[model samples]
Target chain A: MWQPSIAPDAVDRIACVGAGVIGGGWVAHFLARGHRVTAWDPAPDAEDRLRRLVDAAWPALEALGLADGAARDRLTVVGTLEEAVADAEFVQESAPEDLALKSDLLARVDAAAPAGVVIGSSTSGYRMTDMQRAAAHPERLVVGHPFNPPYLVPLVEVAGGESTHPAAVAWAEEFYTLAGKTVIVLDREVPGFIANRLQEALWREALHMLAAGEATVAQIETAVTAGPGLRWPFHGPCSTFHLAGGEGGMAHALDHFGLENPWSRLAGPALTGDLRDTLVTGAAQVTAGRSTTDLIAERDRRLIAVLRALREAQA
Target chain B: MWQPSIAPDAVDRIACVGAGVIGGGWVAHFLARGHRVTAWDPAPDAEDRLRRLVDAAWPALEALGLADGAARDRLTVVGTLEEAVADAEFVQESAPEDLALKSDLLARVDAAAPAGVVIGSSTSGYRMTDMQRAAAHPERLVVGHPFNPPYLVPLVEVAGGESTHPAAVAWAEEFYTLAGKTVIVLDREVPGFIANRLQEALWREALHMLAAGEATVAQIETAVTAGPGLRWPFHGPCSTFHLAGGEGGMAHALDHFGLENPWSRLAGPALTGDLRDTLVTGAAQVTAGRSTTDLIAERDRRLIAVLRALREAQA
Candidate 1:
């Protein structure tokens, strides 16, 4: 068991297991928020890669007005999981998404750590119940799935298993909130949680449209980015309906266009084999003559700038 | 029958029927793009309302760097549907979303317009097949559904029916493009088209979650706007998948997390009754003590600024 030396108001310490992309992102986020982070990964060059990833992300993070020296000074590398989670208040596990491997690793962490330490699994798959079943103390396990490049984005889904204690949930929420994240509590375990489910529905339709030769990938992408996608972030579906009703709210909108749902084509199956191939091919075609890496980098840079401007305006 | 003043660079004109919110929006858009507009509506204050709407939207259009006095000077409100479509190149029908009313009005416009004039219906309901079947010149009929506040948002889905001529489709695309609007053509007539379908899928799940006591409406709305909704506008579902895959792209992301789809709480019926009531009440609760009219105006103003900034950045 571990002992707490730091005051409650002092910066909390975070331990990250598996310094891959997600784990590296956790390091960046916690470090940026002035939390001391001890990271453990078996990969030979894990430390170097994590450092490089953080370095590469600095420009974008700084563009978002989040760069700070305290974040850089708080990062450390460790070889063993026990050492990483030794006295840490929060532990983030981002190992491979395999169930057995994660369960085994988490069980070890739970055994070594104190009862108060919150163990958050960054698994996008497997509900919290199944993953925490092997933990020595299942009450401390929680699902804290963060979006990619967690330091740049601010969404973290805080889900609890049946065995997870309410204190653990509150602690997880509080922890992420301090790290500049928007925490959403999932009432129960559900697959893909919230974001991914909505994403898949849209992706599936886009793929079907491509498969049916309805429109090219470029056209479909342009349609979304220039159309609905532009307004979606500011106004969700319900608000859109309210606006559509023209002062009558959603009920009026529904009364006017509710019957149209029956005529919509929502019967497409999952994107398997050839359909998936077509979608990939279409995306490539749409992005022809442009390097995806370069495109992504440019996009990231612009996004950071836009977010920064919005934040400054809000401030 | 109308006669075309045959010229190589003849100016295109649009006839707008029903000077309500949508019709007024269309007038603002067309007028802002230098398209002469002939508008007609039986509402007593239709002209005054349309003029006010145009005046209100002018700053936003100018902020987009696409508005000019030359375009604004071209608007002209006519006396009747006969005069509105008499000599115009295109007729935009924004009549109420009633089938019988729309069919009757469309038939009248068809009778008054030239033989080759394209009659585009801005109906969110009533597929092209249903609308065209009622027209005398079915070949000239097509659906040009635009989202709310069409003058500010630039997405128009141009769907053709079985009887719609290929020339009409091409002409409509060119027309919208010239007017600085992004046009997407649908493969077949799908109700709500592409955007609304994806939107409804997400909305259904959100409503279900609220109904099941998973979260309050305010929480759900907060989760969306502050979380995934933040990234959606800049990066769509597919692009987000690419990032989620840790630079490997959507395929890898799908392989890793695709299994979660089967377990998600999606695939539920649309929300109704109590749930719908809860959403409205929740929205009111969250928006209590706030003026919606002021909020809308502020949102519109921000949208205009963002679009202008983006345009300038692109240039």
Candidate 2:
């Protein structure tokens, strides 16, 4: 029976550093969860951009049912990193992927934030071990990697660095869970964590098919959304295989053909110029001349419906 | 304009050979679509099992709104394969994945069935060429590969072998589309086709993680359904990445870090005894003492809800 010792009030005030899309998304999500969010970004126009991003995303979160008393007014866009995190009980860093910048920024946050308050990084690539090096209180640093439009997608991959205290990791994990995100707390760092790794592998294969003209970008997209993608939201590869094993279960699925999987032979195809152009042009075509704002609105609508559908089905 | 050249009445009579889960599911779908279905299987208790499977699946499809005149009474179980295909304008073979068995049975079906009537195999792995090589009218042989529980999952990977006629492939593609499926007709044969190749690669990675004791089976499953799986039903890997690129879209996504994806290094780890047992046990734990019947029922219910959700979203 392990438990996080932090007061529940600690998570009520969240500071979001780096006000780009990911950082702004974190602001949206934390704000929707009824937290008071203080955000900071160095960009001259980041405040305006963050506000717009949140305003665009709020309807979807609201449709999904926001927490009581949640409002856009709960967010305060501050000027500097030190000002934003000075009183933050928990800090979330979504700065760019530059290692040196993250190290310096995280160290700065650590210096200003209260003692024992955990800081989480929204890096999809860097391991906490690498990113936590410059922090004076590396023990309280954890990686809380999030998906795009974090308000819509629930996953938040939480992992700690080599020197990160187990308690800090646990505290962050519990906080994320409480924040309404699905938390996958890794025991050790694996490159790309979980979802991105699986996603990248599939993306690479699609690139191969496109390179060889085996399938078009539209066809490749269709191959997924209409196929296995339908089942994945409810089941993963392993358990799905378990069911695929028929009555014999996963052991039988593996025994029959699992060993025969050509994983070793499957590698990322080279990203050539033609392939790059194909992807860019094909994606544009897939949009059918829809603006990014239109696409975002459409996606949010569909995602909200999907989330509602799953909830009803589970019920 | 391309056409299947089959009358509406022609597709109303369907022959389903191989009465296992997949075969039975095809029967259920055809029946629910208001088609008269004749099914045959060599197994002694296959009819009983097939009936049970259909009965178990009917409620879900019914909830999804069955076609006009759809009923369980429309399904007829026959004793011989020839009888099943004697009057069938379209034949679907969902037999086991044994190459020899499929080849022999498909040849026999081609010999008996009406000439020019397309016969589709539901093999998850075998290419159409290998399966149709034994058929005399291999021109009409095509692969209409479907995901498990063909009654539910909408994707039907339609492909043709070397000797298979382009016309037959086109007809099957149109026929499946008419039957209310999302179709991806391949210009060339791909090993494991499109979706399975992606699925198997991810499966192998899970096997690697399990073998390495990196995560439990439940964690692997949760890592998916709760994470990327949430977006997959509408967006494929490429489209998802395009959205991940923020305002930059696909070009920015690729330029920023697509090449940095560690797909080249993600070969599947070897499947070992410990890993196998861990998967089996972890799946059992995830089920929490629920029987396979319970699991299947839950899956069908959810799938029906998902289908309804997608249909509504598109509408």
Candidate 3:
């Protein structure tokens, strides 16, 4: 069994498989972070498309600031997946979302890559556990899902599969943090994970409204970007409601709003004592020693900044 | 029978009933728009709270640029709901969410406000049709629900009940737009309107995740602010996915990522030929004259500005 030897933060050589939009995005992100990347894809025009994507993303990454030695020349597009991972210290798979293809590809990558080098699959909806079922070194396989335009968005949710070691999850989380990414390591594998699930819920509801003719497309669009979407960049649904509870925070909100409402087609969890306590405690932890007053003030300050930024952008 | 005679954009005298967060927010909004506002609330300390809320919101409004003649002193707190609306040209009721309270209050406002004045309720849920049953001038009653912190967030969803005149709904939409709001007038009233239903769906899925131990509160927060939330301010769910469809836009996205994904807690509407056409056409309408390429460029440009602004604000 192989153990992690390189410092999680300092891994220099990375391999990216299945160079479509997501894989190309990962390539752009790594290149900007000043890492040497070896990328592989099966598409006939994968190299040309990947380079175009990287070039398109370059300006934004430069605006966000690039690290020392960051350059597009550092990326090497190889013809074969084995050659791509042969000398790689870390590997990321962003293959098409087909189960049989993913399983077979992951197994092949596992067989080809250096033993114990952690591999992450960027499957938006599949569980890492299921994908790793065919891998020989499943212990090092983890899910490191990212949002669209991975070169810009900072969130990467890391989670280990049932067959994976806890240490691999921790290693992946630290590595992503070192790569100028914000990491959220989950307790277990959940379908679609956190952000996507929330997004899908909202998207599904929007479709339902459109189908019902309750709202038009422009109206639904306005309903979001002009309203709650403005506030969400600084605060999430949970934290926003916590502020809404006035002095009481989440506990107060739960008591006042309750979990039951006729507003959504999605059924919320029962506000059982155990669940309530979990939420209250979780909220208290995230509040991080700030008073509700302080949180609200911070929210307002950030909100003002965001609104001003949006206006400036529009201009 | 009352008819809207004043130019909807130039209505100067407005009445606000109920003086909590939502109501107080409306007061702050109308004041910044340079309208003379009369307010009424039954709470003992309503005046003090309302003043404090407005004062807190003033600086942000100033930053956004106040309308001509705007001043906090233009607001007047009154002794009764009847006194509040008697001389007002437009009435906005932000009462407690109790059906009976809202019904009775609308009836009282309808009876007291001058003929031809339109009344808008700030109820987050509860259809206007249900609330209008008690109003004498039900034809003039329309639901003009604003999101929290109405002074800052610029979305107001306008829809009418069975008893409400289409003219009143149009008047409310025009009035809100003139008052510096982004308005989305619904074709029909649905429970919770559009934005809240979408918000509630996301919120409910979040709570479900928390209860199931699939994610932590901190994870949920980070998942939003750092990931999808950043994109949402510029693109709604439909438009975002439409872009994700690459050159094919919404039609392609619908075909590629069908609504049957097991990712969300809620079930989506079936993609019937009609529903599919509704979404495709809606996406086309919102896309306006821009091609997918142009929209993508715009999104990236705005995103860069937004990210930079957020970073500067944090600094």
Best by lDDT: 3
Docking class of 2: acceptable
Ranking by TM-score: 3, 2, 1
Per-residue alpha-carbon lDDT of candidate 1 for residues A205-233, written as tens digits (9 for 90 to 100):
55544444454545555556556665555
What DockQ do the predictions score, one after another? 0.15, 0.23, 0.79
C-alpha RMSD by candidate, in order:
13.2, 13.1, 1.5
Decide which is better by DockQ, 1 or 3: 3
TM-score of chain A of each: 0.78, 0.81, 0.96
Cα error, residue A165 of model 3, in Å, equals 1.8
Instruction: Flag the better candidate by TM-score, 2 or 3.
Output: 3
The CAPRI quality class of candidate 3 comes to: medium
Ranking by lDDT: 3, 2, 1
Residue-level lDDT tens digits of model 1 in B67-140? 44447668888778899888888889999878788888888988898887778888875688877766787777
Clashing pairs in 2: none
Error of 3 at A245 (Å): 1.8
Return the TM-score for chain B, candidate 2.
0.82
User: Per-residue CA lDDT of candidate 3, range B103-154, in tens?
Assistant: 9999999999887899999989789999999888899999999987898888
Cα lDDT tens digits, model 2, A1-315, are 223335644568889999897899899999988999999999999999899888877766765678988989999998888899988888999998777889889999988988868899998868889888887878989999997667766788888889888888888888888888889998868867777766666666666555555666667677777778867765677645555656655445545653553422363233344433333343344345455334433433444455457568778
How many residue pairs clash per model? 1, 0, 0
Off by over 4 Å in 2: A1-9, A261-315, B1-9, B261-264, B267-315
